[model samples]
Target: MITGIEHIAVLAKDSKALTDWYVKLFGFEIVYDNGKGTYFVKAADGSMLEIIACSGDCRPTEPKEWGIRHFALSVTEDGFDEMVEKLKVEKVEVVTDVAVSPKGIKTFFFRDIEGNIFHLIFRPTPL
Candidate 1:
């Protein structure tokens, strides 16, 4: 039977830099560094992200890309606001500013160093 997701793989032009970016932004720690362009980072909640080294530059994801549009990392409501502010202070590209839905879910989106769009979501109730 299929279980939870093991990891989400992303291609990075510079694997080491991308790995460091996650470590700096989020609290993700390096679990494995294959020395070749592949690295594994483990998030605080035990989620894993596999970064694969690639040669070409990464382009921002398009909504019609026929694949995953974006992936989100959950954060507390307070953390959500703090993250949005931090992103703004750091001059990072903010795709969508913080907004609260009618259902009370707060979310914001931004781009990473590799041009990957990531969302920070906060749900009043746990999923």
Candidate 2:
């Protein structure tokens, strides 16, 4: 049987900065800092996102591009609104305004320090 997703790895020009950005924005804690361009960040639900430092130009995916578009981080309804406000105050680039899908999933997208797009979603009710 297939197990759940363990983690998602992303290559970054500056792993430390990317790790710090997740920690600051989403409360992810640094579980491992190899000091050699590798960082393991753990979220509250035990999901991990690995940030690997690399030497190359950072190219983030954009809308209509192939490959992965973006990954979502589920949040509470209240949290969703609060986060949007916080991002605005922080001057973080908001790629899209808050919108609700046909399925009633509310979400908004934003860019990280490295221009990686992340969707903040709130599912008020079960699908």
Candidate 3:
């Protein structure tokens, strides 16, 4: 039987700094650190993110490259405003302005410290 997603992988030019960024911004717990740039960070709900280091030889892929487009993280309805302000203060690159779907789901798109795109969502109803 298939279980929930174990984790999603993301490449980073600076793995350590990206790991620190996740910890500082989302309070993600470090699951593993090789002390040589690779790290696994887990969110509050056990969702894990694998942060892999890319060296000088790494070729950057376009945003719409054949794999996963972006990772979406959910924010509580009450914290949605606070999170938006936080992103503004951090000077994060906004990929798209906040918008509401027909289902009334509010969402914002932004890029992470390592230039990976992410979606910030506020769902009125839990899935």
Every model's TM-score:
0.91, 0.91, 0.90
Q: For residues 34-87, could you state the per-residue lDDT of candidate 1 as single tens digits?
A: 989899999988999999988665666775587788889999877887778877
RMSDs, each prediction?
A: 1.5, 1.5, 1.6
Question: How close to the true structure is residue 122 of candidate 3, measured as C-alpha lDDT?
Answer: 93
Best by TM-score: 1
TM match of model 3 to true structure: 0.90
Once fitted onto the true fold, the runs of candidate 1 whose alpha carbons sit more than 4 angstroms away are none
Task: Give all candidates' CA lDDT scores.
Answer: 0.86, 0.86, 0.87
Relative to the true structure, candidate 1 reaches a TM of 0.91
Identify the leading candidate in terms of lDDT.
Answer: 3
- Candidate 1 achieves a global lDDT of 0.86
Report the lDDT tens digits of candidate 2 across residue range 25-112.
Answer: 8899999988798999998999999999867677888967998887788888878889888878877788998999887789889887
